[model samples]
Each structure stands twice: as structure tokens, then as C-alpha cells.
Target: MSIWWSLHLRREAASVPLARRLLLGTMESAGVDPDISYDLSVALSEACANAVEHGGDGALDGAAEAYRVTAYLDGETCRIEVADSGPGFGAAGGDAGRLSAEAENGRGLYLIQELADHVHFGTEPGLGGAVVSFDKILKWRKGASPLLAV
Candidate 1:
């Protein structure tokens, strides 16, 4: 079985923290622990920030076109989808490598890849938008992949 929650908000700096908090709350309610909760929060925040940054100009005209987030929970697997009403970008593959020690930026996808068990993009052609999704496995039981055997 799966459960989902969604919300849309202005694509602004202030909305980033709000999005993080709301996602954290939902995950916590689903029994995600504190440490894991922090990971989820950070990953979700970075994804949303990326969306807004690349979410194209005039995407948020005083809360007009907004960014949407959808989270789906199924047992130990929780998938978070952050969608933006703007043009999409090409995949970086799982090649979301970490930034160099001296680099000041470019670690968003890298962090998300490290924290989430799976990360993928859902691009809707013609519609001209995309959904960035990452999945986490909480309290994994036997037979689960060791990478997500938290």
C-alpha cells in the first residue's frame, strides 16, 4: 500500500524552508526517525531549491505558478517528488558526483544521490515541466539492498 501528500507554493526563497518543514513533518508522522528525518529534509530542500533556480523566469509571479511536491510512502520505501512548472534539464545520470574541496557549489544532486536510495527525473514532454524524485528506505528488513538497509 502507498500513501501520498502534496502541496504547491510560490517558487521563492522563503518557501524552501517551509517545504522542508512540511516534508519532515509528513515523514516523521510516517515513523521516520530524527537522524533520518534530517537527511530527508536536506535532500528535499536541495531538490526544491534546484527546481526554483531552474524553474524558469516568471514561474512564481507572487504565488502564481508554483512548485509542487508529492511524497509517497510504502512500507520502508518513501518516494518524494518535487515538480516545477518550468523547463526541464537533461539528466546528470547517477554521475551526480561530489564537488571538489574548493568548489563553492554544484553539490545538490550529489547530496541527493548519496542520501536517497534512488533518484530519477519524470519529464512531461509538450507539457514542458519535470518532476525530480528521490526515494529512501527506512528500517529495511532482510533481502533489502545493503545500500538502503538503514
Candidate 2:
């Protein structure tokens, strides 16, 4: 069974938990293992927080200001993508894993990389925004089929 969902949310701090809760609920409903679900939820929170903080301009000047979060589950693997309309990280994003421990910021991408099985940084599909995408190999609870037959 394969499932996918997407959210377009305002670039506000409150929107971060909303995305996380939705992801958590979806994973739970699909019978994903508790550990895997927790890890993915935390990783999703970091990704969403990044999008909220740096994804786009928060001005209310009639511009379509928002960020996007997308998740896909197929069999034993799940992939997630978070995107924003800001100027993007440019060259800095390439060094995401090299942040120092004492740094007050710049740890979001590193956390995502640590939690997800695979991570990618790029532009949003069709929207030309900064995108951080990752995937994990899921382990479902007992009695859960790897693929849900639609």
C-alpha cells in the first residue's frame, strides 16, 4: 500500500507542530513502528521549523507566502520533502553536516540527515524554492502489511 500527503502552510512557528502531528497520525494509522514513527516525527519537525524560519518572506504584502511539506509512504520506505520560497542556502547547504556543537543555529539540516536514512537538498519541484528531502526505511508493527492494497 502506498500513501502520500502534502501540506501548504504559513511560515509561522505554530504551523510546525501542526505538520508534525499530521505526520505522526498518518504513520500511526499505517501501523509504523513506534521508534520509527518518533524519529520521523522529530525529523519532520526540524524540517518544518527550517521552512518556517527561513523558507520565505513572512510579509503580508499580498504575496503568496507559504511553505510546503510532502510525505510519501510506499511499502517499507517513506520519503518526505519540505520546501520554502526564500533565496535558498546556496553553497552553505552543502556543509550541513559540518556544523560545530557550540553553534546556536544551523543544526536543522544536520538533524534531518542524522534521523533520516537518506537525505537530499535541492529546489522545490515546480515552485523554484529551497527544498530539503529525506527518506527512511520503515519497519511496521506486527500484522501490518508492507504495502497497503488500495
Candidate 3:
């Protein structure tokens, strides 16, 4: 069974926890291993926080007021994508360099990279925004597989 959901949320602080909670609840109800769920939730939170803080590129057209979060559970993997209407990663969009320990920002992307099995950071194609997408091989609680008949 493949389960997927998408949310378009305002670029506000409260939206961060709201997205995290929905993902957590969905995973828990689906019987995903708690550890895996927790990891994904944390990564999701970081991604959402990044969007809330920087998703808007400071345009007067009001185009960057919201962001999107999409999650997909298929077979043995869970994939999540967070997209925002902003200036995007620009030239520093990849793992081109390491951040200093004293740096105040830009840690969320690193955290997401470390927590996810595979991560992809890029712009939203020609849409001119940042898109953070990652995937994790899911572990199901014994008798509670994501593939189980619902």
C-alpha cells in the first residue's frame, strides 16, 4: 500500500509543529517503528522550520507566503519533500562546503542530510524556490508493516 499526503502551509512558526505532528500521528497510526518515525519527524521539523524562516524571498508580490510539505509511504520507504517559494539555495545549494561550528544558521539542511538515508537539495525546477526532498527505508513494528492490509 502506498500512502501519501500533501500540505500547503503558511510560512509561520506554528506551521512547523503542525506539520511535524501530522507526520508523527500518521506514522504512529500506521505502526511504523517509533525510532524511524522520530527521526523523520525531527528531520521534517527542521525542514519546515527552514521554510518558515527563509521560504520567502522577500518579494512584494506576496508569492512566498506559504510552503508545501509532501510525504509518501510506499512499500518499505518513506519519502518527504518540503518546497518553499523563496530565492532558493542559489550558488551554495549543494554540499560545496562545511559550516563552521559557530555559524548561527544553515544547520537544518545538514541535519536533514544526516538523518535521512538519501537526501536531495535543489531548487524547484524553473519555479524559483527551494526544494528539500529526502527518503528513508522504513522499519515496521513486528506485525505492523506499512504493507499490511488496512
In lDDT terms, which candidate is top? Answer: 3
Order of models, best lDDT first: 3, 2, 1
C-alpha lDDT score of every prediction, in listed order: 0.70, 0.81, 0.86
Clashes of 3: 0
Error of 3 at 54 (Å): 0.5
The digit string of per-residue lDDT tens for model 3 on 1-150 reads 778999999999999999999999888887899999999999999999988988997777877999999999887889999999988877677441464434566787778878899988888987888899999998888777565234
C-alpha-based local distance difference test score of model 3: 0.86
Q: Per-residue lDDT tens digits of candidate 1, residues 43-149?
A: 99988897777665463354325778887777678888887766665444222344433446647866777788888765545555666799887653234342322
Writing each residue's lDDT as its tens digit, candidate 2 over 31-68 gives 89889989999999998888777777555652337888
lDDT of predicted model 2: 0.81
List where candidate 3 sits over 4 angstroms from the true fold: 92-103, 145-150
Of the candidates numbered 1 and 2, which has the greater TM-score value?
A: 2
Task: State the RMSD for candidate 1.
Answer: 5.7
The local lDDT score (0 to 100) that residue 53 gets in candidate 1 is 79
User: CA shift at 94, candidate 2, in angstroms?
Assistant: 5.2
